[model samples]
Target: MRNGLSVDVEDWFQVGAFERTIDRADWPALESRVEANCDAVLQIFADAGVTGTFFTLGWVAERFPALIKRIVAAGHELASHGYDHKRVFTLTAEEFAADLEKSRAILEDLGGVPVRGYRAPSFSIDARTPWAHPILAEQGYAYSSSVAPVVHDHYGWPQSPRTAWRPLSDSDLVEWPVATAHVAGRTLAAGGGGFMRLLPYRFTRWAIARMNEEGHPAILYFHPWEIDPGQPRVADAPLKSKIRHYSGLAAMAGKLKKLLDEFDWTRADALVPAQQERARPWRAAA
Candidate 1:
C-alpha cells in the first residue's frame, strides 16, 4: 500500500509551543529559516525519489512565493495549513472560514494547483469542532488530515476513527485521521510529528508496519523544523512544551531518511481517488 507522507510547512517560531511566548507582530522581526528548512526537506524528498504533500502556512507562502513554486516544481502536492497557525477549535466558524479562504487562495495562486487538502494547525479538529468538516466541504476542500485520534493535552479526538473515513454521512469531504496503533490495549500515536521524533526509530517503524499489515495505509506527518535541530529555541516556553518541541531533533533527519527508505509513500491526494469510490458518511462507532 502507498501510505501518505506529508510535511507541515511552518517556521520554528510559529509553532504552537511558542505561541504564548512569541507575539505574531514580532514574527517579521525574527530571523526566518523556513526557506532553508524547506529546501533541505525538498532535497531529502528528491534524493529519496518521493513526492509528498506540503501543508503550507499562508504566511510562509506570502513571503516565500519562490519556495511554494519550488514545491510545485518538484511535483509535490501543496495544501493549506491555515493562515496564521491558529487552532481550529479556538476560532469561531466565521473566523475559521475566513482563515481557510485566505490561505487556500494564496496557496493556489502560488503553487498553481487546486488546493484540495487541509491539515489544521496542530491537528486541532476534534469533537468540539464538528462544524469544521462541513465548512471545509462548503469551501471546496476535498479532504482533511486534521484529526489525531490519540488523547493529547493540545489536540486529539480520541473517539474519532483512526483510519481514513468521511466525517459527515452526507458529504464527499474525507477525513484522513492520523495513524495510530492499538498496543497493550491503548491507542498509541504511531504516526509522525513529536512521536516520530521522540520515540525510538524501531517503535515508529513497527507502528507503521502494523497498520500496513492490517491493510490500512497510514498518514504520517512532520514539520520542516523537526529536521532542523539547530533551530532557535524558545526559552520562555514551559519545560514540557520545550521538551515536546525539541526532543530528539538532532536524530530526526536520519530517522526520517530511514522511514522514507522503508515505506512506500505518496501524497495525500493519491489516496482520495480510491477512497472516493467507496466513501461513506461518518458515524461514531458505538
Candidate 2:
C-alpha cells in the first residue's frame, strides 16, 4: 500500500509547544530556521525518491518563497497549514475562513499549484469546530487531514472515525482524519508527530503495518524541525512542553529514513482518488 507522507513546514518557535512562551508579536524579530531545516527534509525525500505533501504555513511561505519553490520543483504537493499556526477551535468562523484563504492564496502563488488540501495546525478541528468544514469547502478545499482521533491536551476528536470520511454530509469535502490502530479495544495513534518521536520505532512500524494489513493507508506527518536536533531550544518553556518539543530530535532523521525505505510513500494528493472513492458518508461528533 502506498501511504501518505507529509511535512508540516514551520520553525521550532512556531510550534504550539512554545505558544505560551513565544508571542506572535515577537515572531518577526525571531531568527528564522525553517528554510534550512526544511531543506534538510527535502534532501532526505529526494535521496529516497519520495514525493509528499507539504502543509506549509503562510507565514513561512511569505518569508521563504524560494523554499516553497524548491518543494514544488521537487514534485511535492503544496497544501495549507493556515496563515499563522493558530488552532482552529480558537478561531471564530470568520477568522478561520480568512486564515484559510490567506494561507491557500500564499501557497498557491508561491508553489504555482492549485492548493486543494489543508491540515489544521496541531490538528485542532474537533466537535466544537464543526464550522470549519463548511468554511473549508466554501473556500474550495477538496480535503482536510486535520483531525486526530485521540485524546490530547492540544487536540483530538476521539469520537471521529479513525480513517477518511466526509465530515460534512452536505458538502464534498473529505475529512482524512489522522491514522490510528485498533489495539486492545482502544484506538492508539499510529501516525506521526510526538507519538512517533516518543514511542519506540518498533511500535510505530508495527502500527503502520497493522493498519495497512487492515486496508487503511496510513497518513504520517512530521515537522521540518524534527530533523534539526541542534536547533535552538526554548529555554523558558514548561518542563512538559520542553520535553515534547525537544525529545528524540536527533533520532528522528534516522527513524524517518528507515520509514521511507520501508514504505511506498507518496503525496497526500495521490491518495485523493482512492480516498474519495472509499469515503463514507458521516458527520463529525457534535
Candidate 3:
C-alpha cells in the first residue's frame, strides 16, 4: 500500500506558532534557513529512495527559486502553501482567492508544473471556510490536503470524513483530510506536524502500520524546519507554542527516514488519481 508523503516548506520564523511573536513586516530581516533545511530534507528522501509532494510558500519561492526548481528536479510534486502563511480562516474570501492564485502562479512559473495541489497554512480549511473550495476549483487546484479531522484549539473538523472527499457536488477538487488515529476511542492527530514530532515514534509507526493493515493509505506530512534543530529560537513565544514548535527538532530526521523506508510512498498526485472514484462529497457542517 503506497501512501502520500508531504513537506510543508516555509521558513522557521513564519510558522503559526510565531505569528503572535513575530511581526510580518519584520520577516524580511529574519535570516532564512529554508533553502538549506529543504536541501537536507531532499537528501534524506533520496537516501531512502522515496518521492513525495511539497506544499511551498510563494514567499519562499520568490527568494529561493533555485530551491523550488531543485524540489521539482528531484521528482517531488510542487504545490501551494499560500503566498504568505496566512490561514484561510483569517482571510476574507476575496483575499483568499488572490493569495491562492498568486501562490499558484509563482510555483507554476518556478516549478514548471500545473500547481494542482494546495495545503493551507496551519490546516486552516474546515467547517468555517465553505467558500474556499469553490475558489480553489475555479483557480484550477485538483486537490487540497488542508483539513484535519481531529479536535484542536487551532484547527480540525472531527465530523468531516477522515478520508479524501469532494467538498462540492459539482467540482472535482477533492479534500484529503489529514490522517488520524483512534486512540482509546478518541480520534487523534496522526498525520504528522506537531503530533509526529512531539509524540513517540512508536505511536506514528503503529498508527500508519495499522492503517495500512486495514487497506488504507495514510498521508503523512512535516515541515522542513522540523529536522533543522539548529533553527533560531523564538525566545519570547509562549511555553505552549515554544514546546509545540521546537521540542523534537533533532529526532525528526531519523523518524522520517525510518518512516519512508518502512512504507511504500508516492507523491500526492499519484494517490489522488486512484482515489477520485472512491471520494464522496462531505457535507459542509452547519
Q: TM-scores across all candidates?
A: 0.97, 0.98, 0.98
User: CA shift at 49, candidate 3, in angstroms?
Assistant: 1.0
Candidate 3 has which clashing residue pairs, if any? none
Residue-level lDDT tens digits of model 1 in 188-215: 8889889999999999999899998987
What TM-score would you give candidate 1 relative to the actual structure? 0.97
- Shift of residue 4 alpha carbon in model 3, Å: 0.2
Off-target runs (Cα >4 Å) in candidate 2 are none
Better of 1 and 2 by TM-score: 2
Candidate 3 local lDDT, 137-176, one digit each (tens): 9988899999888899888888887788988898888998
Q: Where in model 1 is the C-alpha error above 4 Å?
A: 284-286
Per-residue accuracy of model 2 over 1-286 as CA lDDT, tens digit each: 9999999999989999999999999998988889999999999999999999999999999999999999999999999999999999999999999899888889899889999999999999988887898998888888999998888888888888888998767777898976687888888887888888899998889988888998989999999898888888778899999999999988899999999999889999999879988899777433
Global lDDT of model 1: 0.90
